[model samples]
Target: MTRQRKTDAPRAPESPGGWDVRSEELVAEAAVSGAETAAGSGAVSGTEAPAVSGAGAGSRPTRRGAGDPVKALMHRHRELCERAVDPLEIAAGLEAHGVTDRTAARFRHRDVFALAEEMYARVPRGEEERGASMAPPSRRSPDLPAGWALFALLPGVACGLTVVGLELGGGRARFAVGLGGLLAVSVALRVALRFGPLRSPHQAAPATRAWVCFLLAYALLGDELLRAAVAGGPDEPWAPSLTAALGLSLAVAPGVWCARLFAVAARKRLALSKGLTEFSASVRPLLLGVVALYLCALWALLLAAGAVQGEPAPAGAGALGALLLLSALLSSYGFTRAPLLTLGAAGAVEAGSVASVFAARLPGCDWIAVPVEEAVQAWGPGAVPVIACGAAAAALLLHAARVLSRASAHADETP
Candidate 1:
């Protein structure tokens, strides 16, 4: 009945986006009322007012999958393999792609193995002729001068001089000669290590190897002189006793030096089997020639000195010379096989030799001591030390040979 009179239908306020103006006005009024309530509540609680958004609308966007670093690296690795790129070039590429040096270093071997396997698998059996195209460029090391091998003989000169000093000279002269010889050998070794034999990967620098051998010879001579000087001159009651103990203790010094030299040489040749073989082969003959020359020269120098000084040579001097010659030969053989281990073994032998000398000179051990003492006296005051040194050297050489042979066999077995 209230609508009985024909009235126009109620019309809603229109907006361009199909929203109504009346509804918008109501919503704005409600929002304003809520904001006022919130402000009042904050004031009562002494709290800061909440931040309001300045935007009329807002939206949140999620990140999409662009790439995986590791996957990208694998792809790059495959590409490099297909192209047969140099490993150095590939490494540069990896560095540019955000792979840090630390990461590359940590994964170096693994990455190399992976790359190698990838390259190996890429080779086609059908295209055998094309293999040459993929081969790494051949590189040859420059040929060094032939005279480089002779450089090792410089230390031999020191050895020869030291032998002359020990056998032909008086006590004070012997001591001075030994000290000078030791110093000379030391200097020669330092020079060889820095700029001579160790300068090459092949150990073909005969000069350095020769120097090492010469150093050994000089040490032997020096040890003899040191012991002889300590034992021969003074007649004090404590002199013999003190000499015996000192001789035994000091004997190990030369052995230790020998071991250190051998160890250093071995470390230098650690990964170079071919070079080691070539070096050892070339040096063995040179060493033999040098050793023989050294011995003959030692005897000649001694005879010449005795004649010059008008002094008779020590009793059994010629007979005992054989012991030294034999010892030198044995030692040379020992140093060839496995230098470090041989040297260590030689040290043990030297220690035993000193003990033997001590036991030989021990009072009340007549039966055991007498024969040993007689032999030692024939060799010269400190000559007994050389017996043990020689034995140690020979043993070490034999052991080294066995080890090297085994290593070669193992290498042959490996793929």
Candidate 2:
């Protein structure tokens, strides 16, 4: 049997976190041999990470050579790395400590994620006593502000009273009230989401932001346009469907509630979890349950709104609402790209469904819209958004379950 070489672990630097070694040279000499092999001779093989005392907590590591700058950071945050469930958790902690991508670049890393990966990999994993693995409550950042969920009711109540006012008033006054109510409800929604778990951690690009707006506009106008197309061309000016608007408006409260529930439950489960596998096992079910709860609430709201309007439930608008909520939830947790892509795709389908109607008017091009025409004829225009956004919502829910279950995703989150 070949005898294996084992090096003693590098001692940590003496920082406020109680590190002991306080020298990057010690870490460089004691770091994994694989690092030297990868970096070659020019690396920080025996170099030191000079630390200036009293630089506060956010000091940068100044080291010579090119091997690995993460070694110094790893030691400084030794407690964090050893306790982290994975690299993502470490990344969150780093970001919370004011480490940004530009700061990460000083370490020759692409971003905080890359720097975190190196640090996580360099540190040796140690087993802790049962339940001791949970991060301190302060570091285990919760996202929902106190009493934020209560704010969700404002939008729904404002819109509901507006709908009632529309019924009581007549002629020009009713039109004016309807327009004013829409603006009021819009403001309430913005305020409600601003303080809740509904706010995304990462702001989406302008284009995807427009996609969400388009989905909302489509919710009001798509049904009327599709119905008109089905009835052989537009014979009158298009009007927004109050049911669709009301359904979308009412969805805000449930979405905020569901988001708050998910955030609280996930953080609780994270604290109780002993390992990554255990956290995933417990949190995934909680995510699905929250999603189901939201769907149930939304469906009931849509049904009631439809009943009030003396029409069938706008199932399509409900689907779009579900999609929007799921996307926002995912984005709030730093999983921005997935939700943006999914929402963009759903918007494309809705836009195409409407465009196909007009495009089909050309000779020899009717086949291009055959599927949409058939779907609209058989199930009405609601079928288009129902199919599109429903699929997107399901896809997002599945992705959310997988991504949000990670202990790292919730690390350093803020209320």
Candidate 3:
């Protein structure tokens, strides 16, 4: 018999572009080699046959450079974030660039998701660095009284003048009291927000500074809108519309400023939540209380103005209603505990306000007949909507008070 020649097993076919060799081919070669080795030893071992099969079944052909795409995607995301690009905008850009859901799945490695999380995570340190670099050097010590304390008294001054004017001032004086007080308060708060927070105890907390900016913006936008409507004397029909439009246009600055502050606050909040930075719990309640009280007073004065005029509820009434709802909704996001409950209370008030608006607009509603004082009291049988709003407002104030008290207690406890 001719002697049989043994040869080495066949190798896997190499893929082009350095891609992984075919897994099935490698498995087949392994099985054949294992079988040959087993047969050569003696009788073919059963364990050897199953072992080869298991090896092939467990083996997977890894995609060539699977990590490269994920790394590139994460890098791009980080770049966009650093440049202050919105995540949604980044997502849109990715879609435009043909980075689809399937493309993401194609790179399905655990590291991919982890890397993506890291990519979007807030860089609080970077924010602090940017804020520090942009902030002008202290022209004076933040503690040096910048006359901002007087701005704190503006609300009380405006309120006292309003009460006195309502009780004794003539029609012209009442009008002046209403318009001038609103103007003074708005201007003072705007200036204070711009400069005050950057001074004194507030200077240390960038988040609080941002919070003040948001408050100033919100208050100014509403007040300016009201002023625009009222600036034109009641006799001048066309003037009110023009003035209103101008006011809205001018108010855009505060609106933009507020939006920017919100973004900053969100960044800071994310950093705080992630435990990447420290944030003061005590200062938040004080800031929130100041804003809540300011907004409440502004809403009250607007209501009072509408009452004094005996005219149809000014367009500003709607603004107050909107503010009420917004305040409720925003309270959840404010630096406080039990935000969900706060959200629900605000939502209830908002829903009630909507219902009232619809009810008031319905046929024969005769909202005009309701006296302004009674409406403000919101206590009569027909004043359910106003009552609900007032109650919500009261609850919000009380909650803020509770928060402030808690913060104060904590502060006293601390060194």
Candidate 4:
């Protein structure tokens, strides 16, 4: 990711004394909506919004008459409004909770921005901006420092050098070189996920991560090996696709960068917007632009792979790479559900196709492998991930549009 210029780096909004803006937001939402109170050491615990006590949410009485929706919202977010520096800050806060012009109409306001304006004016803040609130700085920097971009290259360079060593090494030396290459790739990937743009709060479980590992391993050996099985050739299945492995390894850099760009742009859009519809309008173009940039990067990398190897990559490798990059983006953004399932499904299909070709040698199951064998003869084994992962990536693109466009999707974002 390009380092955001210093001047463009987002400045933290000056907050009122007594409570952190984030803490206040959490407290207010809980007290008003969930009827729960937090007890803390500071003034934060004392300034909670009022709600029915010792009663279920169904039994709680409305705080305002049916005609005045503003009163209800104002009451619900009282703490947030009182702590806000400006109406725009309140507007951003509301929009983060899925509020919009349409919802605001019920409150008799022209838009969310207008509703926030009224709320800000109504709250009485005796001491608004004396200093930073009790909380430390918000964990919200979207920019990845240029140093990180440089660091992102470390893995690809190391992987490339190791691959060169593997190609040059012979006999017993090949094992050592391959082991070192795996180590280098692993450490570098950990760095990308640990601090750079690829990190997320909601890490997948180990069981889920098995699918990711399966996809990477399959990318390296699954295609060529499957073809050998289809032809009934005596080729070694363990003789991996070095170019495909390189493609997957080098992907870490651009994947981290694209995610960083998307996050920075999304945060900027969230702040400038007044309504959800306006924000969504802004998100669509940004999403497409980022995806286009990623595709270009992928194309360049694929070309580099072909040049280095002295042989062109399989046409289907492009589809596999796209699916892998999109899955990484989705995981980084906390939209893990679809990506995990897609990865698992794609890996399963590849493995199942291979199994079917072998299963045909069994008694009555000769026809079981016919479909796979014929398909391989018709389109090559690369068609498996090309079909499965290409479809998965398309489905994920749709999922990303629907969820990532929402401000709340990134509400819990960390630096």
Candidate 5:
């Protein structure tokens, strides 16, 4: 004769809540069955066969005292029928499982369908906390207030501009005037913003505020120097002073901005990665190189200018050097990406250089004789060397442009 097997009965709800009661009953049954199985297995020897030979018979529902299967099923049907079901109520029920008040509030703000979907996602198919083991310990500092930043920036801008002005003016009356004017303007603007109804003080770092202010001042100075350089009138003693101011401004301004920008970008990226070693490794070298190159170029220009005239060659020389350095920096940026500002500045520099050369040459009418006479008048016996320097600078600029173009093309070819 064939042996018959028994199976565990399906759960029948016998409470006010249909699925809730069923789920609880199933959980209790599973726990009780697991305990019985453990006890039975322990009582037998390792090699002994189990006495029970039914399918899920030992795993039968635990709430047998409540009712028979048919009666329990009817109770479940009655409980479900008693409720006035709605989508929102359903979502709220599910969300009550493990969600926090804040999360529930956010869900409630959404439409019914969205709330339902969110609830469904939250309940089942939930993922374990992953990527947590990979994250590094955070080392974030509290953010400084906007007011603190504004205070710090005010002093830095003032000091930087004062130093630049003093250096440019060379202790002359004109330098004092220019420096005072710049300081007054800066102070007035800051004061107005601070005390006036439009009290929106800039929230940048001190260095950043200084650089921005200096850049503005330097731009004005650059225009003046450029005009002086191209003017047909006799060279004014103050022309060199104006040029120097412009040079100093350009030299420090962009570098300050770059440092600030890079620092902010790195901080954001690091936060996203939780200061992971791999991310730091990737960004460190590039940032270091940019800062090193910029500082080195600035120092080299200063040293070279000092050597040429034996006493710093006036502010004009420094200004010119700054222009050259700025051009190179801008060109590099343009080649690597798309710096429209840099490109425009380069075009202007090139155009200005060409225009100056033509203007100088046009008056002479004869290239050889004209240059000779102009050289004699401009620098006395020393004019020849100055002329040669100008020629060399022009040549160097042209060569740089060609190299930059090739490099850009190569970069474009890269995937």
Candidate 6:
């Protein structure tokens, strides 16, 4: 309030047309000052000022070129991304970016679809693309052959039925219906298994199964035969019936197994032929030695049986000699042709008959009362040793022949 001279504030400069020059100048100065500040802070460059208009200028806090913010942000982001994105960093970034809980949870769980979508969005416009339909289809099943399935069930059927039949019948009937049913089922199953659609005829031949069945039947039949033989007397009616059954079964068994062998030989013709040749070559000497021993044993046995009957040394020896010769001849013949196994089998049958006849005659001998006397009377106590030697020889010869036959058949099969 001292000397209050009306000192008007320094007036702003004037402009044409009575405009408020000071206000306009002030606005312009403020804009220039802002631009300088922005430039210093690196938000914009001077060259971009002319292109920005009223609204655009407001939108952009400072002048900038088209790619400026994007380039700068991309550089900054790349630097930040170079620092590994640990779980903690990811969580922090999510929080800082104000990401929703659901979106953040998806990121934390590493959802593959979310990741793919993010990658697709981040890629600069035009790049190679693919769709979900390109993925391969899933496989759900396996393949198997039909023959294996069929063959695998045969053993189960046979064993199951056999057990059931045994439990039900207990040998009351010669052939129980249940046992027969089981056998029938087994045969049917075997046939089906062998001849199933996927099996080869050569591999599934029914003759093999038939042979096995026959062997089993034959063994069963032999028990009946032995029973009949033990029980047989002039007055026994059942003995005759059992004897007949036994004879029939015994007669059939060898033939059936032989037939199966023959079928196998025929199927593998070349192999069998080769095997026969090789077998014959290897076994000739061994067979001769065996035959000689078998003859000696047979003669000794006959002499002992004759001595026990109070007969002369030469009485039964001739017949025994004939039996040995027959066996050797049959065995030799059978080796050349597989059917000969049957002939040899028949010879064995004849030998058994001869032994039985001698055994029946020996009971009335002079040495029947005393064991020592019997031993002496029966081939003079040398009968056992001689018989043992003969048996050993026969066994060796038979083994040699068998081996030779198998070898020859095998050799024939080779190329």
Best by TM-score: 4
Cα RMSD for candidates in order: 23.3, 11.0, 17.4, 13.5, 22.3, 36.5
Residue 315, candidate 3: Cα error in Å is 20
- Give the clashing pairs for model 5: 153-206
Q: Summarize candidate 2's per-residue lDDT along 1-415 as a digit string, tens digits.
A: 9998866433334443223344444555445334424333335444554444442433434343324545656655778987776666787677667676667666666667777777766664435632454545534446356778678888888889888998899989999998899899988987897788778666677877899888988888888898787667889988777887787788898888788787777777755654455667898888888888988988898888899999888888889988988888887777788888988999999989888888888898888888998998898888999999999998988888877876667775642
Cα lDDT tens digits for candidate 5, 239-292: 333333333433443443443344344434434431123334545554555455
Pairs that collide in candidate 4 are: none
**In candidate 3, which residue pairs get closer than 3 Å at backbone N, Cα or C atoms, i.e. clash?**
none
Native RMSD of candidate 4 (Å)? 13.5
Give lDDT per model, in order.
0.37, 0.75, 0.36, 0.69, 0.37, 0.33
- Which runs of model 5 end up more than 4 angstroms from their true locations? 1-148, 155-220, 239-415
Q: Please, what are the lDDT tens digits per residue for candidate 6 over residues 1-415? A: 5786764443322322222333233334334334323323445332222233333232222222322322222222333223322222222232333333333233332322232233233323212222321321111111124454444345445544543454466545535744575566556544543333212223322443343343333222322332333233224432112221222222222222222233234323322222223324444544355345544554454455344435444322223233223332333223323223333343343334323433443657423224423433554422322343234334534654554333222222110
Q: 1-415 in candidate 3: lDDT tens per residue? A: 9998866333322532222233222334334334323323433211111111332343222331212333334333445434432233333234444444444444452222232343344322355655653532211112223564444444445544554564577768867765775576566544543443211221223443343333333333433332222232223322122222222223323332332333234333323231111222433544454455444544454555445444333343334333333342233234333333433453454344334433554588747324422443453222433343355555655654444322111211011
- Candidate 4 residue 379 Cα shift, in angstroms, is 2.3
Q: Give all TM-scores, in the order shown.
A: 0.33, 0.73, 0.31, 0.77, 0.23, 0.24
Error of 3 at 3 (Å): 56
| Native-referenced Cα lDDT, model 1 | 0.37
Candidate 2 total steric clashes: 3
Clashing pairs in model 1? 151-207, 152-207, 334-397
Ranking by lDDT: 2, 4, 1, 5, 3, 6
In Å, residue 386's CA in model 2 sits off its true spot by: 0.9
The best-first sequence of candidates by TM-score reads 4, 2, 1, 3, 6, 5
